[model samples]
Target: MSTTINSFNGDQQQSSSSPDVGDLEKHYIDAKAFILSATTKDGINLYDHLAHCISQLLADQPREGTDLVEDISKTIKSEATPAQHDTLRDRPAPDSEHSLAAEQKPLFEKVDHSEELDDEALQSPLPHILEQAYYFEQAGIGLGKDESYRIWLALKQLADKGQIDKLRFWGKIFGTQKNYFIAEAEQNVDDETDENELHEEAHISDDNRHPNEEEMDDEEDMLPKSTYKPPPVVPKEERGTGANKYTYYVCNHPGGVWVKLPIVTPAQISQARLIKHYFTGDLNKEITSYPAYPGTERNYLRAQVARISATSSVSPAGKFKFSEVN
Candidate 1:
C-alpha cells in the first residue's frame, strides 16, 4: 500500500512538469500566421520584423539603467555635427583680402620732470621750514616731519609754478565729496593784473546780455516802481590786506593740478554767511539755497576759507601790530 501511494505521487509530479503538446502546436501556428501577415504587408523578412519589434521594445522600456557615459557620448556626437557644419560654412577663405599694415602709432613717450622739480624744490626755504617744523612738532604745534616735508615739497612746487613771492600750505578743508588741499600764495603784481584782465574778458557786459535778461528787464519795468532804493553794493577790496590778500590755489590731492580759485566777492561772502551748504567738489556747481549765492562753489569755498582764517588765525605776540597808516 505504501508503494502504490508513492507511485501516485510520482505521476502527479510528472504531469505538473510536462507541457501540453496541443497548446504548443497552437502557439506555433499563431506565431507563424502573424509573421506571414507582417512580412506580406511590410515586405520585410521575419528576421527584420523580429529585429524591429525588439528595437521598439527597447525604446519603450524605461531608461533608468542607461549608461551615463554612453548618453554623454551620443549627446556630444549630436551637437558636434551641426557645429562642424556651421564652422565649415562660415570659415574665412585663406585668400580673403585683409589689411596687414594697421595705422602706424608712435611709441609711448614719457616726459618726467619730477627729479628736476625735486631739485628745485630743495633750493627753496622749504628745507628751513621743515627743520623748524620738527621743533614745532616737539612743542605739539605742527604736523609730523614726514607730513611737513610732503607739504613743503608741494608748496615749493606751487611757488615755482605760480612765480609766487611767498607760498604757504593752507589748512585742508573737508568737503562732502572731496577735500581741498589749499595753498596760499602771494602773487606778483603783473600776474594779478593778467588774472584780472582774463576775468574781465570772461565777464558778460550789459551790451551783450542774453535775450532772457532783456525779457526780465522788461518784466521788471512792467511791475510797480517804488522809491525804496536798496543800498548800493560795496566794492570789492584790494588783494593786499583784505579777504583777497593771497591768491588761493586748491587741488583735491597733492601732485595734482592746482586750480586758482576766483577772487571772492563781497556779495558772495555775505551770501555764504547766510546759508550753509556742503561742498560738492565741483568748482562750477551752483548753490541753491535761501539768499542764493552770487557765485559758484569756488567763490563760496574761498569765502569760507577767508572766514575760517580770520577767525582761527594766530600769531606770536608782537609779531604783528594794527596800523592805520594806510
Candidate 2:
C-alpha cells in the first residue's frame, strides 16, 4: 500500500491553504484506508477529523485564489442568526412600488470583510457531500442506489473526482446485507517462536509484512467475520471451461494460529482442522485445489486466518459471505 500511496502522491503541493491537488488525494486515500481496516475505528466515528480536513480543502479551493486572503479588509458583511434567514433580510418593505430596488441588490449581499473572505474558499469534496446530504434530507428525497462501483475502479475515479455523486449500490445477493459468513482455522506452522520470539524477529520496513503478524489484534476481530464473496462471473470467453481445469480463488486470512469454527458439520470442521496440514505441504493436490462457488454446498474448509496479503490495501465498505462447497 505504501507503493500505491507513493504512486498516487505525486509532486503536487498539498497544504492547509486551499487544497492543492495532492491534499485532495491524501484525504481521498485516507478515507479509503480507514474503511478497509479490520480495526474497530470507523469512518462515521472519525467524521469530525475528516470534516476538519474537508473544511480546509474547501477554504483553499475558491476562485480568488491567494488574492481573496489579501483583499479581506476590503469588504463588510452581516452575521446570520438562527431565527431569521439573513439572505432575505434586506428585502424591500412594500409591494411593486419598490420591486425595482430589490433587483439592484446583489443576490449575496456583502455584509462584512470576514464573510467575504470566507466565501472565497474553494469548494471541497467533503463539504460538497455534506451540503448535498443536508439538502436531500431537508427535501425528504429518495434515489435508487447502485452497487457496481465498490469493485469498479473507473467508475470510482469518476465519482471521487466529482464527475458523479459517489454511488451507493445494492448487491445482487438475495439477502439485504452483502457480507458473507466466514469461518477459518489458524495454526502455528512455520514460526520457531511465541509472541516474544516473533517480536524479536528482524524488522523490514516494506508494506507486505511478509508473514503479516502486525495486524494480529485486528485480525482477531475479523477472525469470526462474515464476508461476501462475489459469485464467480466467468468472462464470456471462459464460460465453457470444465471445473477441474479452472483456477480456484482461495479466500482465507494469512499469518497467526487457531481457527476454531462454530456449528458447521463434523466434515466441514475436519477441513478447517487441516489448515496446518494444507499450509505445511502435507495435503493432497485435489483437496487443496478443491473448486469453490458461492451458495453451493461444496464441502470445503475456511481459512482459519482472515486478512489481506501483508500488502497494504484500501478496502471499500462492501461485504461478502464465505461459503463452503461440498
Candidate 3:
C-alpha cells in the first residue's frame, strides 16, 4: 500500500509539471481563428499580411546615410534625360535684327530752325549778363549760375529767332502742374497792325457827322435810339506803353516751346483783381469765379504779372534821365 501511495503521488507530480494536450490544442485553434478573422477583415491573405508587417518593421528601422543617398539617386534616374536635352535644343535664339536696329538708332533727333533765326542779329550779351548776375548773386538777389546760364541761352535763342530789338529774362511764375519761364522782349512791330485803331477812327468820324447829314441818311432814320445807352468804351492801351511795352513769351522749361501770351487789356486787369485762382498751365481755360473774369487764364496771368511787377520792381534812381526828344 505504501508503494502504491508513493506511485500515485509521483503520477500527480508529473501531471502538474506537463502541459495538457487538449488545452494546447484549444489555444492553437483560438489563435488561428483570430488571425483568419483579422486577415479577412483587412482583405489580404496571411502571407501578404505577414509581408506588410515585415515591411512596416523594416521601414520603422533607422536607415544609413548611404541608403538615403541611393534612394535619391534612384529617383533622379527615373527622369527623362532626352526630354531635358530636347527642351534645351528647341529654345529660340536671341533676335539679332532688333539688337542691330537698336544699335543703329540715333540718341537725339536733329532739329533745323536755321531758316527762322536771323543772321544779322546782335551777338549774345551772355558775358556781360553773367558778370552782372555774379554781382547780384554776391548780394544774394539773383538766380543761381546754372539757372541764369540756361535762361540766358533761351533768351539768346529767342532774340535770334524773333529778331527782337532787346530781350530780358522776366523771371519764372510757379503754377500747379508746371511753371512758366518768362522772357520779356521788345520785338520789331513793323509787321503788326492794330485793327482797334481803325474801328476807333471810324466811330469818331461817325460821331463828328453833322445832325443834318445824320437825318439825310435813310438807315439812320430807320434806327430808334430812345434808350439803352451802351457803357463808355475803355480806350485800347497802345503797345510800347505801360504794361504793354514788352511782349511776353512763356515756356514750361528753358528749352521748351515758347508761347506768346496775348496783350493784356485794361478790363482783364480790373477783373483779375476781383478774384483769385491758381494757374492750371492751360492758356484757354476760363476763369470761373465770382465777378466772372472777362478773359481766359492767360489774360489773368499776364494781368497779375503786370500788377506784381508794378508793385515790386525797383530801379536805381537816375539810372536814365527821361528824354522828350527823338
- Candidate that scores best on lDDT: 3
lDDT of each: 0.68, 0.31, 0.69
Candidate 2 per-residue lDDT over residues 1-326, each given as its tens digit = 99878755653334334667887899998987775442322222334444544554476687754565433322211111124436656754688435523542332244343544343233221223334444655788522122121222222222233322123211111112212222111212232123521332222123214454566555645565346765543322121132111111121111111122211222333344444322321111234333221111222322222112112335566665468788
> Could you estimate the TM-score for every candidate?
0.54, 0.13, 0.51
Off by over 4 Å in 1: 1-150, 193-223, 315-326
The most accurate candidate by TM-score is 1
lDDT of 3 by residue, 244-308 (tens): 87777898666666787766767778888889899887777888999988667877888987888
Clashes in candidate 3: how many?
0
Pairs that clash in candidate 3: none
Off by over 4 Å in 3: 1-122, 125-127, 192-231, 313-326
* Candidate 1 per-residue lDDT over residues 127-205, each given as its tens digit: 3667778788789888677666656666666665656766777777778877788888776656665464256436624
Task: Give the range of the ten consecutive residues with the poorest summed lDDT in model 3.
Answer: 100-109
Error of 2 at 138 (Å): 38
**What order do candidates take by lDDT, descending?**
3, 1, 2
Ranking by TM-score: 1, 3, 2
Deviating ranges (above 4 Å) for candidate 2: 1-83, 86-146, 154-266, 269-326
